[model samples]
Target: MTMAWGRSAAVGVGAGAAGVVAMTLVEKLEQRITGRPDSYVPARTLERLLGLAHARGRRAWLHNLAMHASQGAMLGALRGVMAGAGLRGPWASLMFFAVRLTNDQTFENASGVGAPPWTWPRDELVVDLAHKAVYAFATGVVADALAVRWGPGPGQVHAEEFPGRRRHIGPPPRA
Candidate 1:
């Protein structure tokens, strides 16, 4: 039950993209209801990372879209790897949601394009978390589906072999 790293990553990319699409749709709806302006932190972060000058107007919008899509697709790879390891279901998606938030904070803060989550308004934080959760669970769904071709992951196998064992039972046998 070895993990197929390459295949998993490839599957993840696709899953991530799908997750981004789902998130975007949700964001759009939420924004329409709340009249929340689009956040351009992603575009700013991308510009800083690429040593490009700050953009405005339509250019900024394009940059934002590019960053949003690429980042989601890239993160989806992690979810795919999780699925490849048999970490499927809502629990796994919950974990991935944390990962997604961590990744965003890390990059956004490091680039000095965004403030810490604690500094954000309560409503803003909630909106952000909701969007990321959507991405995580959506990506998880895709990754879990794609990884089915590889059968149960090592973790699943281990769970079956040692349902309630408290002792270290060692790794599951190789397939």
Candidate 2:
């Protein structure tokens, strides 16, 4: 009856949605800035285009959603924790976002534009970074919301173990 892992699954779904939107917005922004239309689609949509759902049906959707959401949540959580820990600021934030932007290679490669050296590198980097940072932030927000119901907590038990068989009870009382 308990849906303990539901939170992570929900996070994946939300993250996938955000990924789709983020990719679209970035492509539009890039096109405007560079005056070139780049054939781009959201990351989540690409997975579907690649026939994820067609091949796996409900299980595929569930798997993709969970995987994407977890990745987004992890990135966001790291950024947040770093910021809160006083180990990061605007400069670090910029770098983090920039690092995430490199993930756009899939979109660019798909366009058949014949990648040119240093072609709009600065613009793409800037745009993708900003877009990804926002995507990461959005993913975190959704995860936090779901965490209220699904986040691991102080004394939560691992899903792999039965309550009574947990090591906390000293090796299940020697069976």
Candidate 3:
């Protein structure tokens, strides 16, 4: 099956809205766990994954959102391929999540935005785990959609990996 931008847009907007909801829920969960409002930034996660230090305004958010949609389509297409190959159930989901997490984390580390291994505290693992869990599901939705669209037949998942790559930004001004 061919990739349709219209369907992709719907999935993207839908997934992004879902992502916002998921982020909100994660914040509430974190609050319940630790008794304070969660202040983790989604943009930071995405930026770190993209190996960027800072994206200061609305333009950055728009760029990130588009990048997300493109990534989502690729994941969905991969899911479709796996399903087409007869994979199913929880394992399929696990594989898709693993692909995204490993790729994202690896990219973050490779691009120099990831936290240094030695700097990671045990407490931080909880937060990271929470982020991974939510993103895993959201990514799965993307993967599933793509799989449905491109998994069964001749085509592969065609979403771009990182859309319109940004050059490094100037360092932020001192507070």
* Candidate 1 local lDDT, residue 160: 88
Q: Give the per-residue lDDT of model 1 (tens digit) for 13-70.
A: 9999999999999999999999999999999999988999999999999999999999
Considering TM-score, which of the candidate structures 2 and 3 is the better prediction for this target? Answer: 3
What digit string (tens of lDDT, one per residue) describes model 2 on residues 1-175? 1333444454545543664466457657767977975322333444544544332555555554554444554455544443332223345455545444544444335543225325658866466555677675554444444454533432333332455544554322212
What is the C-alpha local distance difference test score of each model?
0.93, 0.47, 0.54
Candidate 3 segments exceeding 4 Å error: 1-54, 116-119, 137-175
lDDT per residue as tens, model 3, 69-166: 44545555555455444343466667766776575566556656566534778676667666656755664555455546544422222212223545
Best by TM-score: 1
> Cα RMSD to native, each candidate?
1.3, 11.7, 14.8
lDDT of 2: 0.47
Kindly indicate the candidate among 2 and 3 with the higher lDDT: 3
Residue-pair clashes per prediction, in order, are 1, 2, 7
Question: 113, model 1: CA deviation in Å?
Answer: 1.1
* TM-score: model 1 vs. ground truth: 0.95
Stretch of 10 with least lDDT, candidate 3: 153-162
